[model samples]
Target: MPARPHSPCVEAAPNGSFFHPDVKEAFMNAVTTEIPALAHDAGVPPAPPEAHRTADELRDIPLKRLVASPYNVRRVPPTGIKELALNIWKVGLLQNLIVHPMKVGARKAQTFGAAAGERRRLALIYLFEHDYIPADHPVRCRVVPVEDAVLLSATENEMREPMHPADACDAYRILVEAGRSIEEIADLYGVHPKTVQRRLKLARVSPKLVDLFRTGEVKLDQMQALALSDSHDEQEAAWFDAEPYNRDAHAIRRRFVRDEQSFVSNRVAKFVGVEAFEAAGGAVRRDLFSAAEDAWYRDHALMLRLATEQLEALGASVLAEGWAWVKAMPERDHATRSQFRPVLPRRTEPTDEVAKELAAIDQRLAEIAAQWEADDMDDEVAERLELEEGALSMRQDEIEGSLLVYHPDDMAQAGALLSLDANGEPVIERGLVAREPVAAATTESGENGDDDDDDSSDGRPARVAAPAVKPTKGPHSERLMLRLNAHRTAAVAAALAQQPHVAHAALVHRLLAGEYGHSTEASALDVTFRDHSHNLTKHAPELDDDLAFTMRREQRRVWGGVIPNDSDALLRWLIEQTDERLLLILAQYVAASVDSVRPDERPHAINALIPALGLNLADAWQPTKAGYFDHVSKDRIVDVVSAAVSPSDAMRVAKLKKGDAATEAERLIAGRGWLPEHFAKAEVVRMKLWDVPAKASDAEASADEAEADEPALAVSADDVRDDAAVAEGEGMPPRD
Candidate 1:
């Protein structure tokens, strides 16, 4: 730099007479130009030189003086113009619009043509149209060269990051907290008032959940669901309890509300009617984020009370209709109604006028059906046919219903069951009669031996007992008999376990029975079966909550997972299994099928079987105060304690309160190996001796002596009877 030219970019320091050497050199190199090198030496063509332009100046110009650029790429929607105008009106222009001076002309006298922020320009026009701003209002603008305007507009429109939803929510909330009305915030942000409201709702979510949303751990919809509840505890609980993989909006909402909330769409809620329920002081919780059906009635108890009251009122109306009795319940499906015998409605012949109307309706329905059957029919034609058919069918149904009317006499003896159908419509089950006991037949005789006599000569009918009819049972009632046979089968199973020979014999007998006997009577034992296969109507509630039940359910779940879903694959897998494994599997199946009467049902048979199987009930069954003693009578509790400990111990607890006694009884019976009557084994019967001839009497006596010298085998006549009854295809003997 022998003689460097003065440069504007490089300035001399106050203490120095010349600029810095590096700064001066950089400025000289930037200003100096060089010719291209030889092609052979350069190897490639040189890039074009960088362009230089003067910096644009920002200026405030009149709104009318700024005109939209014809070459602008961004198109602002018409609806957005109003929102944009509101935003501009509230906050003023956030960024200056890029514009260039327009050439002066007769028709075009505007000051500049807008490139960037065309939407802002349109928004200003909107404000002018809406009388919010004067026509010549001043708008901020960046004065750029004409060529740079389109590039600036495209760059401004394309290069920007969207605001994170959480950030936006927080921003909205901050604005709200700063004393801004929702409408004001909406106007400032160019959003709907509802949008602002929703953002505020989201902002009210628990801080922890909001943090999770900010970190992207929770989704937008999930956050919305959490925001449905104002309680921080509920929001946190719902978020934490939700399955990570299945944290859907619905699941999140369900977790937040739980069973405490009942949907308005639910049958019970519909039956009660939302208006009536709310009138009864039930609070209805609506999801601001969802549709109307998503609303829930928070007070379930109040809703139920209202529903019950309405149902009872309906029942009263039915009772007033000369019925013997009326029952109102929440549920009255076929399963419930089947418990009662329905009195058949007396049939009546239709009157001539009604018959003619029914015939005409039926003919019309047939014609409509024929018309509807046309393949080339238009949608309108098909819809018309359907409407006509529906009308005719309704008339037909009315006529048919009128023909089947109950007599007043029958109604007097029978009753009606009132309940709500699936759609919340009233379902009246009429002509339901109470189950009558089966009565015994009576015989009458007169002095002249006439059958029409009311009484005998002694003034009483002879009390002759009716001959007993043997139960002709051959799978008469599958479900009832299955339960009855299950008990007998359990007892037999316990016996057969001790005597493997008996098991083998029973297996062979079952196979033979299948081949020779009826298919339905193939086997008494349900060896291949599943647990909880049959739906039990009656059982202790604790059975469901029992630890053993839970363990069994988990075991079944594991086994079900390992088992092949395809039948063919399962068969193949079974064929591939070792004999020992197969036997173990079979044992599990057999054990699960031993649906010995539940403790609440006829448990005597299972009680008898337990000891025979050498089962230590103490190992499997522990009597808790709530599970056992609490449910039993005080006398039973004392008896249990007495049997387990001593009579004194029993007497000590007998004077205590029932609950205290139960607790004490439980402690006493803990390790005593004592069981309730339902669980205790029945007495084992001994084999009977038979009469022998005198010649063989001495030998028989010697043999009997030898048998007496050996240990006695415990057996039961009831067990033997059960085995016989099973083999004979007859119903089991009644339990004692």
Candidate 2:
């Protein structure tokens, strides 16, 4: 073959006689394409040459001879390099670095520059500096051609995804299960010990919840809440019981453990003291991941027992003080022990020296107050003065306390009551005399005609006959009154449902109450309705377990579920809703805030308004054992039965036990449209629309005008009917 001249694609430089022209193109054209076909015909395809070296090749390269490439895609921070160094020292290099032979000047020694793993090279340098590894120690690396090293580095750094959190947790768990310490695992992975522990904790969560987390059904924070409990049953139950919107971390935590545990910060718990309760074998659950104060004590029964025992022990001294009797109670309420009259403690004059000290304290307090008023004091001076004032006040209190003592005679006749104060401290109410004995003495005096004497040497007050007047109607039993009010409230709700204009006016009344009234005294009619029903839950020990509260809570939950979650969506839905549906919602709100009783100032107003609204109390209310009949006295139960059915039926149950009588009364009045005096229509001065307060009327008038001007949209009338029925406890569907 004859030699050919160079192609024009590669031209000669101006100064040079000759230069390579189109060398690459010439080379490609010169090579024959039949090589692969010839190999295939021979029943074997030619093997492609390797583009890059594998990790196995060039494994033994000296650390001193390896230098970091200037064009590395990833850079390791200085602190990260130190941590990486420690990890490499502990576990050795697990991944091989990619490197290529570096082209150096004549003065420099031959060395390999890292292409893909600059962090590993830096870590090796750090090890050498720390004397953990020799400068010339050999490291494992995969060597590639210099021209291809940058591509390999970019691919290695960018192509791979970080490990998924669940997978990482599982891996940590596997290591922990294989007898590796948390510290050891942390060091190997270049993370904190807490990080490793958290991952391991996450791995131990209920398997089903873990699956949910992996599938994105549950979030990481929710998973953390589920991990709070080791019991899979509680975890699974919380997940299932929580509504979709209520599946937040806090809600999950509350649902998981609130019922089973009581916080140490509770009044009863503080009174009992966590130390003493724990001493008595009551277990406390503490969250290691949370703050120290965030702990709960389990076994409420045991805690209560410990508290009662402690209270009794403390009350022993009071009982020994010649008291007629000593009563110990968990809380101090006026109603519980109001029948006993408390004897005032006799105040004795302080000793001359003590009196002088008190006078000096008073003088010092006066001086400080005068100085504070006269001078523009700095904060430090003011703080010092405050401390001095507090100290003097405490001293005065101590002196006053020491001077007061109970008389022996009074202590003999009166009793002591021990109770926990609001701050959970033991308070002794001393010298309380029985009202029954006082009343008996008065009765005996009347019988003996000694009540006429205004002056008696015995120090007892003379009794006088009360002025005669026409007898007023006796009050109904509390249960009966509550049942009556419930009926009235239902009637009010139904009446409001039929009239949207009145409903709108009532809503305006609530809005004005909230806007003009104090925040603490704001009307309860703002959201739903406010009724006396919640009062029944206030004193109940098991508030969450109460039938009424539970039922009401579930109803609220259903209401919440149907409401739009997004604010804009809710606005749109409200805008599109019909007047009847809106009225039905507003009626529920208005009916809840009704307070039509004698003591309330606006009772006559509500009474007059009820008739105008056509509220049918009998049709809206029915008494049930749980809601009413069971809580009444046996005589009251008999009275209710007598009023509803017959006197014979009342007499039939009068001889039975209270529970049995109540049950009978409930059955007798099951479907009867019986209502108490409070719910019945009464004669009262009619209230005009102008009777509303001037300020309130103006606000309401504006609101009414606005509502009237707004156009109403179409809504399902069936929906309004369903809501009214639900509110009145009539034909509501069973909750899921």
Candidate 3:
């Protein structure tokens, strides 16, 4: 392989250098040699022997006498005329022009139409116009009947190399217009429906460019870039910017390029403007293509690659395991890593086993038929019996026909013999299919003591009775009646009502209509509480837990000493309050002290405690009773409480959600006698410090990933973090 040039593309950066010289050389060599090698490997399969007279027999026929076969039309290559003219001028037409006999009533003005060799027809015209060949050149045209020409043309197109994507799109439209199904067209073209769809997308691109693509002057990747634009003007602009020189050529190769991050960012920023971008309403503050979005795309793409690799590995492993019999299995149905099952050797041929099972099924069918004949029958039952008989026959045919069933033992051993119906009864059967054979004379009655009733004697055959239907009931009463042992519903309700956030709780007289709304009776209690709050507002009253609901002495002592007295800010303050007990519980379960868990854990703990805090329970609680707390801004609570405690201590306290006892204890340790300013600064520095190790770990992982794909020069999380850390360490904020 030749050495790779310092610059592969003309527009590469001045500083850019060859990163993988060996791989680049190999790739270039493969590009030039692979196609011809593949074509040679395919070899030439002989076409059917000539169906009609050779081209020389029809040389005396005038060009004007020939007409095209409607079935054989294909797009003529743009350079085809030149190539054909040259070929004719030198060696003459090596491949004879295939033509059909003209219609009997053809007018004098009628022009010759191409049957198979449209390229040769066009080339002949070019030669004649240039005076390189005589206007009445004795062309060697293959003469065939008109009917055979049509069939030949259709078969030729179907068996040939598939059309280009642009050609495919136009072909699909033609097929559809001619009343062909999408599936039929897809099958005929040997492509997926989705592939056809993408071709259609290419076709939908600007008409002017479609011609360029068809002519092969433009590449697919460049066409993709043009298609990305919403309008012709934008497409022209993007095309000019991406491919300044040889625009048509670039359009053909557009898929090779990726959108530049800086370019996309600048475009968006200009469209929205910096001030408006910042001021955008709720949840629109982030970039349209966010870091999270990019991360998701990368992760998903990586997973897909890994999954494909694993599947390929499993396929190789399966082949190595001497599973030669099933080697021709479809790729789609081949066992994946998760689904891999050992292929055990079988003792008997599947057909022989199925035959044996069928015999036994026949025996059982004899018994069932005898029993049915003994029972009284009706028209409805007779009709049902006929339907069942037909179904059984179909199932038997399927069992016998499917390649899925191999050995007789496979039917039972594979657990595929019997299947439960909708009514939870085993109705569908696979083993040996029980049907008509049971009534045959070869099946002896005394051998199995099974019945054999002849249906031919009577006009009406014995029919199987349908199962009786259950009567329907009215809609369920609007109540949940819980019948319990020992515990009373009222006692549980009372216990629930005594909680700090509960204004009232009682046994709901009627079930709530909506999923989460309180019943009318419980809603009355809320009304009473609201009235009480309104009355107390005159005296600037607040939520006095003692006045609202009684509590145990220990609970009161815990809250009274730690919880703030500002009831007006109870929800926010409650968020700030974190119980030491819960932290200790978490610390014990995780086997880690409060200070040891990573910074991310602080948020996780706070999220866990939000429900225990009795905040945002209504909005956040899902139908399944799981919740996401959002009563107060998490930032606000973290900031306010951090002012009075160490960041580590604050994190622990916030995680607790039980009380603020630990935060108070931290204040005592500092010996700061209400010196809140000092504590605030300590918390900020400590919190920021905890993030350092995490960010460093992320950077390390990213660096490792980038190293694996060393020559690609791809942007990744590690690259971003590496740059960010450098900026931050140098006393500059990281750029977005």
Q: Quick one: best lDDT, which candidate?
A: 2
The alpha-carbon lDDT assigned to residue 545 of candidate 1 equals 28
Q: Please write out the lDDT profile of model 1 over residues 666-731, one tens digit for every residue.
A: 777887766544344343322212112124588878875554344323343246446556547743
Write down the worst ten-residue block by lDDT for model 1.
Answer: 46-55
Q: Write the per-residue lDDT of candidate 3 for residues 268-377, one digit (tens) a residue.
A: 22222334333433112211212222110112223333334433444554444333322211112211211222222222234777877666556655655674785577
lDDT score, candidate 1, position 388: 76
Prediction RMSDs, each to the true structure:
20.4, 22.8, 35.5
* Candidate 3 segments whose C-alpha is farther than 4 A from its true place: 1-165, 174-181, 211-218, 222-237, 241-591, 594-736
Judged by lDDT against the true structure, how good is candidate 3? 0.37
Clashing residue pair totals per candidate (backbone < 3 A):
0, 3, 20
lDDT scores in order: 0.60, 0.61, 0.37
| Residue ranges of candidate 2 with Cα displaced over 4 Å | 1-90, 97-154, 176-201, 204-209, 228-258, 269-298, 309-360, 368-736
Candidate 2 lDDT by residue in tens digits, 1-736? 9877767644643322122335433433443243224324544322123322332256788899987564454555435888888888887898998886665556877677777788888998999998999988988888765444545566687788987678889999998889999998987878889888778878888888888888899898888777777788888888986567657786666655554544544666778876777788887764545554455766878866776788889899879878888888765444556566556665666789998998999899889979889566899989998999999999887787677676788878888888765456787777788766434323311434543554223443222222222324434454445444444544454465456677676566556433322221122243445343343233322232334334443333233334465789888988898776666665554654554422221122344445456565566556666556666667778888888899988887786657556656777798788865545534332111111212458778787555433322222222333433544763322322
* Model 3 worst lDDT window (10 residues): 478-487
